[model samples]
Every structure is written in structure tokens, then in C-alpha cells.
Target: MQDNSLPVDIDRRPGATILSPRGDVDMSRAPSFRERVREAQAGRPARLVIDMGAVEYMDSSGLATLVEAMRNARTEGVELVLCALNPRVKAIFEIARLHQFFRIVPTVADAVEA
Candidate 1:
């Protein structure tokens, strides 16, 4: 596992891609997050799962990046799902009513299958 102060690792799986992001995804790091996510999606896998179990903080920029990713995935016909969102992150999505927009799963495996 590649470790960084930002705490995110992306692992590509066959027929599915996993973005295991950890730590805060705020303004300073949001661009990197977006770039990494976009790179992951470039594979055009049938499934794109973002594993957020370790994400402790996410600013609006992060949310926007996620929305953009979902948009790209939709346009590309790739199934995108977010998984293991901590309470704060989940609440952000809930408040934004984004919970209804994307498939939120409890685990990476579930997201992969979804």
C-alpha cells in the first residue's frame, strides 16, 4: 500500500476500479483527489468504487470533485459507487441530498458488485 500524508490509495481491480481514499480531502488536496479519481476512471471499468472508510474530512471542493466524477461516469456508462463514508462525510452528502444521486454502499466489495 502506498502511504502519504494525505492518506489515500487507489487500487485498480479487474473489471472494477477501487479508490481507497483516506484522510481529509480538502481544498489543498482536492485537486490531487480529482486527478487521481479521473485517472482511475480512465480505465473505463464497468464499476468505479470509491472507498472512503478513512476519510476524516471533506470540503465542498471534494464534494464537487465527486459530483464531477459521477457525471463523467454516467456519460461514459460506468457504474460509480461510493462506499464506507464516515458520519461527517455521509452527513454532507445527506444534507446535499446527494445520497439519492449516487449508489452509496457499506463496503468496497459491495460497491464493486453494484
Candidate 2:
């Protein structure tokens, strides 16, 4: 179990905003994670990229939070992208068949361009 105490980092790019949540995104951190995503969405950037490079683990709650964010992005007409997902986290998305629904990329640069 990785540390869940680390705060989510939000970065504002030219045409996009990146939300980097470190550590495991479990039930305990899901609310905060959702809030971070909402905050990024509030800015109404053309692209909102979630950098999951440092996330080692994520449970159903985390998945739900992401789904909610995706729905919100859709309603707001914001392009939500995910990037740098580790194998473990990526496998979860694959298993859930959510990778097809999301704009998943291998790098932040790719996500930004996508």
C-alpha cells in the first residue's frame, strides 16, 4: 500500500491542465481526487489530463470517481485525457474495458496533443 497522504498536484498548461495524484487512489482519497478533478474542470481548459504515473494502486472507488469526472467533462465539453498510467493501474482500466472509453495516452505530451 503506497502512501495516500500526498496531495494531488494540479498544473496549468497552455491549452490543458494536468492533475497528478500520487500514491494509491482508494476510498480514502477518492473524494480528494474528485475534488482535484473538479477544480481542474472549473478552469474549463480545452484538455484536462490526469497523469497517473505515480499511482500504484486504485480501487473501485477511485474508478467511480474517475467515471464521474469523465461524465462531468462530457457535460462541460472538456476533453478529459489520461496519461502515464502504470502497468497495475493500466491493467485495471483494461479489465474494466474503460481504456476504450478514455483518451489514454503513453505520455503527457501525447495527451495534450490528443
- All models: lDDT? 0.86, 0.88
Assess every candidate by TM-score: 0.90, 0.92
Can you write out model 1's per-residue Cα lDDT over 24-74, one digit (the tens) per residue? 898887888888888888889888889999899887888999999999999
Off by over 4 Å in 2: 1-6
Cα displacement (Å) at residue 62, model 2: 0.9
When summed lDDT is taken over every stretch of 10 residues in candidate 2, the lowest stretch is 1-10
True-structure lDDT of candidate 2: 0.88
**How far is 77's C-alpha from truth in model 1 (Å)?**
1.1
**The 10-residue segment with the lowest total lDDT in model 1:** 1-10
